[model samples]
Target: MQFDEVVYRIRIAAGGGLLKKKTKSEERVILKGISGMVLPGEMLAMLGPSGSGKTTLLTALGGRLGGHLAGSITYNGKPFSNAMKRNTGFVTQDDVLYPHLTVTETLVYTALLRLPRTLSKGEKAEHAEAVIAQLGLSRCRNSIIGGPFLRGVSGGERKRVSIGQEMLINPSLLFLDEPTSGLDSTTAQKIVSTLWELANGGRTVVMTIHQPSSRLFYMFHKVLLLSEGNPLYFGKGAAVLDYFSSVGFAPSVAMNPADFLLDLANGVATAESNEDQAAIKQSLVNAYKTQLSAAVKSELDVDSSLHTPTNDRKLKRWSNTWLDQFSVLFRRGIKERKHESFSTIKIVQVLVVAILTGLLWWQSPVDHLQDQVGLFFFYSGFWGFYPLFQAIFTFPQERMMLSKERASGMYRLSSYFMALTLGDLPMELVLPTVFYAITYWMAGLKHTAGAFFSGLFVLLYSVLCSQGLGLAIGAAVMDQKSATTLGSVIMLTFLLASGYYVQHVPAFIAWIKYISISQYTFKLLLSSQYESDQIYRCGTNQTCFVRDFPSIKTVGIGGRGSIVAVLAMAVMLVLYRLIAYVALMRVGVTRN
Candidate 1:
């Protein structure tokens, strides 16, 4: 694999928070005309200080860069294509595996979603088992891959699982970002050794590593040292020390060569002032150009004629059919969400809120019109806020996972999205049902079964609509905190215009009442409760309930409006999901 003159830049957001403007965005260069190459049967380790363009270059080469990039990347002397991308795998620094899945299950799902359609279920299982053995994860194959709250796999084991996930596709070229960043020295060396073994099997592996142990450093076939987006050194790892020593920047003692290289790249011992550091860095660059460029060029200039085609077939960009993608994703989604959605704590929280609400408005009747209206308002508000906050976390929590899978060309955005939305529907419906069931009879709003079920249907629809709105917010913002803040603002605005709080909205903004889901819900509840036109003794004389409250009629309150509310919510649900799909496609891949 080879990349030449790669350039990447991003426009940073101008101001802080959600209220900021984008008018004054600034451009920050990530990669500046960087170029490099790696051959089969070799492992290249890229070394750089923080923000030295190492990961940026890796992202560009892996076709995952989410900024303005200009470069020519080629594999097998041809321009990089979708087929090449499918043949490449990239492992991010953070392992984004599902906590609920066991080691074997995770790899199995990855194989199902990524392996070719020609392979049968048995074939996929066989492949997954093979990978588990190859990665030395057979010992933990049945152990659950855990997160901060769930303890299961060790960190080194988890990292290996992440690599194994990519290996299931049998990729020819692999890229990793700081695979050993937080591991112990022994574990880090072991990981590199494993990578070295993989590379020895004729797979090209390129990775960005920080301050590696000397033993780990020698395992790499090539070393590309970068500083401030410039190549300070690029040559054989074993010869790096000799090359640097020849340039009069030799280590003072028998220290780890990786540490010495980092000191020079980070300017730790190179100079006492900024200008002096710049001079030292420049001198190193000049030395590399004069002394080492030829040897590097000769090594990288692999003869195209020498390359031989093997029996291994190239893989397609996506392995699963569209329907198959959705099915696999839906199954995975259901498995991952069952615990969160049906957790004892969440169920208990919903029940407590429902029972407390029911007790507050127990046995309410028509004469107590104020309390009935308040109850309806409370019901609408709770469902609105509950589903919105719950769905707000859906995208942010999965951002890294989605990014990794999407970059790997695993599945379509629409397929993953439809599966997620469909997978959550059962829970979304069931939770609201529990809330409605506990409160419906105790509150005594209506006795007729038709009205009760209709109200429940409308309530469920409203909650889903709210969930859709939350999903759109989460996907568009890409930050949980910002999504939450924005969702709160939106929920509050809807409540204020709900016709319960502001009974008489200003004429200039009267349109808000028409759009506020809460208003529609309140109208539907009122219509259901007063469908019989029952008489109430509010002032010692009988008076019709609808007559006392004429605003319900003007606001289009009835069974017809209830039907309209459900339909409106359905449309909003689809609309919001469509927006979310578009947002997901751009979340980590779009330039700001």
Candidate 2:
């Protein structure tokens, strides 16, 4: 309910890269024993200029700072636990929302995963609606969150929604980073006022503000003035002017408190005596330290007697509920997937490619033998690319949403990994089916119902394999641009390595062919075509024509190997999914 004592001390300095080559001359101490406290129903504003360790202090308070520090933070009368970390909510600078989802859908999905399972669907929806109303987002609740290509919610409403999501967990403490960085003065004041109301409702709110307007500045119950990570003041906002006046400067009524504090910390106008400034700084530091130490010690003593045992029992109980955890995660994943475009462009693309292939290899009375080889190569080669492309584009988009949800503890990594794999099936089936139906008949392959179904199955399987590859790559590299580039390179390498065009590359490169999803898919398609051609000949001309196509003979490894290849590709997909999940989990855990 309250942060009894929060101490954030940071040691930052330039260090060497791998091999210990010196990168900079000396180390710098950014924050030096900065400490503050927030009681229940209190709003604290971290006010400082740029690069003053405002955000860094918040990170340290939240146990997100991956830095060396010498301080302790206590929630109430005990050291903060991992449960506190899980319960605490952090609203980041960017409002990371899925552009396709409406505000209501977004909140509903978050509630389903984060709200206790004891709540019914109607209860969850009711809770979500209440939060939306509280955040002043009801007007835009049903509107879509937009991206560069689409029009949706406005920036201010989006920001509120971001905060609303954090509030959904009903956390006792909330940390926000620059909540009004780019907003207009009026909008910024509104946001700050909303935060004030939240704090008044008993949620301890702490946030960093760079240069808030006068109205916005006056809203804070307490202000933490920091300069290069050193605390100047950490008390009542009204006391700031009096403190500055004591140091020999009278602040004008119109002068912003934020500016007045920055000037004092950075030493503006006439520079004060070094000894005097140092003494003033030391006095404030000691005051905070004493207060924090007492609070922390008191909290620790109480926690030792009252909460530690129960905390362990709670953790043990939660650990046993894996099924419950997975169900919540699966539901969230389904919601996220439903919002994606699934690329209508891709569907159209598959149809176009199918029609082109059909036209290029249209059936004829006098079949040129070389045409069979070419058709076999084309079908195998292009179909192999399907899975690769699908994975590359789709997975990157999903990864962004996944990262946000994963951080919020929507579900476990494995649940999302499975749900995404299954969720993609419907879209995956649609495009590949369209491609196969058009290309199969157009290429003039023997069209017995058996052949048609067999080719469709092979194509669909290949596409899934490629989707797996893309998802793996996307998960491994969190950045969309980097993932796309890496995926493209890998797909290209696989395409060339598969024995489609360069049939007899060296034995050393032969290993690539075995692992390549395209290799098996191409081979299977060729075998299917050969088998279908032979069947059609038996039915139409009453003669076996399998020996007529030389390419079929060269595809000599037989259908058994091709089946094994498909299975192997599927296995590789599973492995990639596992690897992706592991990588993503590590990322989520480490991210601040």
Candidate 3:
């Protein structure tokens, strides 16, 4: 891989969205005409201080960057393109695995989604096992890759799993971002050494490192050192110390060369004034321009037409078919969510809430129109809010994982989105049933089979709609706390406009009732239960109970309303999921 005259300009917003309308914008150059090359068998390490643009440069090289960037990058002397992107692998700084999946299961699922379509199930399984063994994770192959609430693999093992994900593709070029940031010194060295070995096997590797020990620094064949977005040195790793010595910044006895170089780049090498540090930085820049740039360019300069095509046929858009991707994601999703979906604590919480609600509205009288309306709306508010609050965490928690996998072209985002909807449907469908079974009879709701089962269907479908909305919120925000807050606000808006709390909203916002799932659910349940003619006295004030709610017809709670309510839920499901898919596609390899 080779890049020349690479430049990137980032527009910095003055003060986020809260800024005044007429605020002037500013532009900061993150990368400034950076140029370099990596041969087939070379390990290049990018070292620089924070904000020095190491990660930015890595993203450009991987062909995954967004926004304004200008550069000419070539692979095997041909200009880089999507085909080259497919032929490369990038492991992000953070490990993005499903915490609920075991090490082996994680790899197997990724392999199924990413491996060539020609590979059979057995072949994919074999490939996953090989990666497990190669990463030295055989002992913990079946252990979970846990999160904050779970305990499973060690940090080093998790890092290996992250690397193994990219290794599964056997790409010609690999890029990693801070692969050793949180690892122990020994583990850090092992990772770099493994990259060196991969380079020896004729696959080019590029990575950014924060601080490396002397031993680890030597593993890289070439080192690119940047200072304030400019290359201070871009040449052989071993010759870095020699170059610094020639520039009169030699390291003291027993001092690590990497540390010395960092001090020089950070403008703290000498104990003199700030003016002296500026002078030193300028001198280093001039030295590279005068002595090294020409040599580096000569080594990488190649004729554009000298390369031959590697493949003669067209490449498949995806390794797995859409259905295959869906089925795999479907099964993997179930496995990842089984514990949380069916856990004893979650079930207990549902039961407890159901029992409490049943007691609150227990033995509701059929003659009291107000109680019936209250009961229906209570069910609506409870089911709608509960499922939405829980589902809000779904996409936000997995946003990073999805972003990384999708960026790698593992599977179509549409397939994953559809699978996600299907996978949660079963669990989502079951949980509402459990709640209804516990609360419906206990609350003395309409006991007839048609009334009971129809209400149950409406309840389940309404909950599904709420879950879809939650997913959209999570995807749109891509942050758990923010999604939670937004979901609460949305559910509250739906609740207030549900036509049960206020009975009549003001003319200005009455239109919100049409969009609230709770309103439809409440109307559907009311129509299902009250279509019967049986009636009793209402507090000795009347013999019939129809006078209490005169707005039923006006609110559209009739036979047609029942059907429209169900259809509305279905429409919301599709609409919210479509919104989620688009939001997910726009999300990148990392949260903003």
lDDT of each: 0.83, 0.69, 0.83
Q: Best by TM-score, which number?
A: 3
What is the lDDT, from 0 to 100, of the residue 133 in candidate 2?
Answer: 89
lDDT of 3 by residue, 44-99 (tens): 99998898899999998887887899978778877665566667899999898888
Off by over 4 Å in 2: 1-30, 265-267, 270-312, 315-341, 364-366, 393-403, 532-554, 557-559, 588-592
Candidate 2 residue pairs in clash (backbone atoms < 3 Å): 77-299, 77-300, 78-299, 358-442, 387-466
Relative to the unseen true structure, what is the C-alpha lDDT of residue 42 in candidate 1, on a scale of 0 to 100?
93
Choose 1 or 3, whichever is better by TM-score: 3
- Candidate 1 on 1-592: residue-level lDDT in tens? 8776678888897776678554677898877666678888999999989989898888778777655888777778776567776688889999999999999889999999988899998899899999999989999999999999999999999999999988988889999999997899888888899999999998999999988988998898999999888788887899988888888887877888889999888765543444477777788777777876666556657787845443225644468898999999999999989989999999999999999999999998877777877887788899999999999999999888887787777888878888999999998889889899889899987788987887897788788888999999999998999999999998888888877666667889888766677777777766666763655656667565653564454455555666776677667878888888788766663221
In the order shown, what is each candidate's alpha-carbon RMSD?
3.2, 5.0, 2.6
- Model 1's number of clashes is 0
